[model samples]
Target: MSDRPKTPTLDRVHLPSDLKALSDAELHRVADELRAETISAVSETGGHLGAGLGVVELTVAIHSVFDTPRDRLIWDVSHQCYPHKILTGRRDRIRTLRQKDGLSGFTKRSESPYDPFGAAHSSTSISAALGFAMARELGGAPDPALGDAIAVIGDGAMSAGMAYEAMNNAGHLGKRLIVILNDNEMSIAPPVGAMSSYLSRLYAEGPFQELKAAAKGAVSLLPPPFQEGARRAKEMLKGMAVGGTLFEELGFSYIGPLDGHDLDQLLSVLRTVKARATGPILIHAVTKKGKGYGPAEQAADRGHGVSKFDMITGEQKKAPSNAPSYTKVFAQSLTEEAERDDRVVAVTAAMPDGTGLDLFAERFPRRCFDVGIAEQHGVTFAAGLAAGGMKPFAAIYSTFLQRGYDQVVHDVAIQRLPVRFAIDRAGLVGADGATHAGSYDIAYLSNLPGFTVMAAADEAELKHMVATAVAHDAGPIAFRFPRGEGVGVEMPERGEVLEIGKGRVVREGSGVAILSFGARLKEVMEAVEALGARGISPTVADARFAKPLDRELILRLAAEHEALITIEEGAVGGFGSHVAQLLAEEGVFDSGLKYRSMTLPDIFIDQASPGDMYAVAGLNAGDIEAKVLQALGVERLESRRA
Candidate 1:
């Protein structure tokens, strides 16, 4: 018997206009049903749960008060937009979330009219909103695209520098924009719901409120003083520490630390702002993540990401792993190295659990640093730690490390600081799509002057590389490993520091040579086996270092083989490109040596399983065999005879 909550009120709401007809009490009922629906849909599909639950009333309030699609509502990162999707005419297809050729997990403009801007990455909403806000004021309103822009960003996301940069700009612009600071973490501004509203009302009518800086566009709708003993009241509120001084300093009229779950308060403030707000205003609504769901509320990260689960029991049905994940290998190996060296330390940008640094933190809490979502600052902070003689392993996702690239070059590479980068998610991630794909790190990091880059073929190799990074203090080094469970290879009793800039020959062959970088080594071997039955035995070698170019091994392979094929799970300018450059310099290509480089094509692939995505890329075992046969100018039909 499915205990799915009956949504009589929600069934009437097909769009935002339908929401406006409902009373405040009825709207609360709608939010409750919506929350139940969100949990139920996610239980079937397995996606982001806690974030959506936290913002149910806020989503309801915004849609009811403001004209969406006209009044642009941008969800920062959009991890919490499941409920927003439910409200904004997407409830029917909500069960198809994160599926192949179905609705995306994050906010996409193509998904619906209500999703004004696409966002999977954090700290980008404010900038996008400002652009829309500016366009609206400048008479550049396009059909169904322009209106008052509202960016709903979380407290963790605000820790990034870009959010402040956008806030600084939004403050200067003074466009009729709204920023709802969804402080679920309660890291910034304590929860004092009534006190927050009282102070906000008084502050809006303070002595500073009357002075409208029209030149800078800092003007409030509230003209002057409001009531009897107002000055004394303002002084008392100030003493109570109930004002949003940080946002106010940025030139936006700030409001609320109100109860986001309270429909009455939410509706009241939103209606007032929609009618009378002159410039940028930030509504600080403090709500608990996983607000209604008991299991989600109890768990850390508030059930942020999930697998398909039973709605009744709140138990996830994740597929059991045969081996440890690459993330765990890196964390465990780094912890092992830390046991040997007292100077060793680890850093992560707010994803301690995701990166497996929570285990490290448990063992050595003093050494493990969770720097919040400030990747740029995390990179530089690691650099500073390195300069001061501590060996800092900055563990960040390869996609996110792009945020701190300039810092990587200027702070670590230029100065020659030995900051070890343990890059997780080094290839296409499944449902998160192109935005979270770790496809560019190899190309980006390898081009730097003194940087050394390595990609682990499997979990065991990842352990060795962790050891290698710990021993190598000469300059900056990075080692990347893919997501999900590693191939069940035999575990080494202890890690051994591998020699720098070397390649290991995995198998011996004669007709052709297949040089591989990264986790594609396993696929290369499978291709070799498929080729073996056709009498085309190919030499296989793992090029450990992409930058330094395993000179002796590559040259020997190039000299002996009739054809050479290089493969990597990265874009064009990555490991294979470096191999091509090395071969060209050595005049290997001059001899008309049949050479091919397999790289990810110049296209952004959408959400699919990693296996399905790789199939789309044509880097599978069969794809590799076909490439080899073509390179050798041997017909597949003819090769079978030999």
Candidate 2:
């Protein structure tokens, strides 16, 4: 074997087919190379470093053992697919990972054939893998051969109900499948669940390999019909002792609690499992996040995802910020509210720091709860808190809120529980891209009965919205804000509660009015300034609430202005859609009113700088001004000075 590191070899093989040609020893070398390449790529691009590093060996082993593109391998959440991407004809583009027009931060179906199923959110892989397995059985693939279907999921993702639902179904159906449990005992933060605790105990015990061997030996000793009966009995005994009391009970053949980083062990066990696995099989592989990198491993959050950093020093190169982020503002505001009112409490779904709930947690530890990545549980838990006369703020990211949509409708909205949803990252997230984008909350939340949805136009507005959520005790209320630092706008000394369903006109103008919603107000202001230089002064109003929509103010603006434009930082069905529905009901669009709705285009935008993504979505000031001028039928040259 060459003394040089295997990553250099990995740099040469850009496709899965290339990996297939390599010998077993060469494949082991490729695994090390893949790890180094992944570490280097993430170190440069600043994305899900820890999770991706944890699965490097697993990625190589799976690709080496299975005929990928023919046999689908679905990675749960896909945050750990950097190594997988490197091996699948994407190594050349690794440097451009998360850059504009470059590789996606998560697995994208559009990006490559190797990504059989795309995922950004957690708990999706098992269901998707099962679907692929069923589809293969239904004659979707070129050959009728039962294509291998595997799902590599983390112990953290297993906390969510969907994974269990998929496992239950897969077990019952007795489908030929592989579910590799990549247990690192962390998920952005240390995972929380009875299941997580159970896995941790199993990891400590190290009984899986011994029990499996003993069971197999006993099966081989019996004869004929008695042998089959003994085999079944052995399975039951193994389930009772080790393999899986839970999974085997659900009807799957539980195989391991193996060491994920052990190349020989992983390859040997995988080769064996691949041969005789009749029903669904679960392989529990324990790994260490940030496995190969010392500095990353030492970091507080295990360098889960990072910004561009110094490779030698492991120090992040951060852009200096004048003001705190919207998350911080929300946390501070919520903490203040909790201090003032004993009923106030905060909850997050595995994102205390991201949601700015860390401050609240620090101040009032008992009142704060981090419910792992189970957004559905977080919502219902908040509802339970509310039902018990406690005010619970279900602080979750806008993208994650999608996981609890049913809970929001059934447990909170229908029952009219006062669960304050502090929806963070409420618009197009930049480097993390579309999967993490808070694009659908406005549309999804606004339409729910008894749901009061609001958008913060700025940091001060976010503070007020938090206060409003605290004060409002009637029903489920939510306020969304985008990702990034506040726009250096003046913050309030203390949060002041604002009236529900109200809007404030920021700048007064004639002929054309721009209705700004959420974090897009900064861009709206810039557009207004640009239009002023062009001698066309446009009115700008911040319509705070998406549901109870400041309708009278909107109608007044419509009556006074020659043209009206509705702009929001969400997808088609959100704030703009609500405005359109209101206007149509009021007959604003009946007379062919000069109108336009600005929203994110119906496309999964790739990773890029926030400004660049905004420009692409036409939410930037220049883009907004140009669209407004065009909508009003004004020539570009005529507006050179609107």
RMSD (Å) of each candidate, 1 decimal: 5.0, 3.5
Query: Least accurate stretch of 10 residues (summed lDDT) in model 2?
Result: 213-222
The lDDT of each candidate is: 0.85, 0.85
Clashing pairs in 1: none
Candidate 2 — which residues are off by over 4 angstroms?
1-6, 20-24, 143-146, 206-244, 587-593, 636-642
Can you give the lDDT of residue 599 in candidate 2?
93
lDDT of 1: 0.85
RMSD of 2: 3.5
Candidate 1 structure quality by residue, lDDT tens digits, 507-604 = 99897999999998889989888888988898999998897889999999989999999999999899988888988898998887889999888898
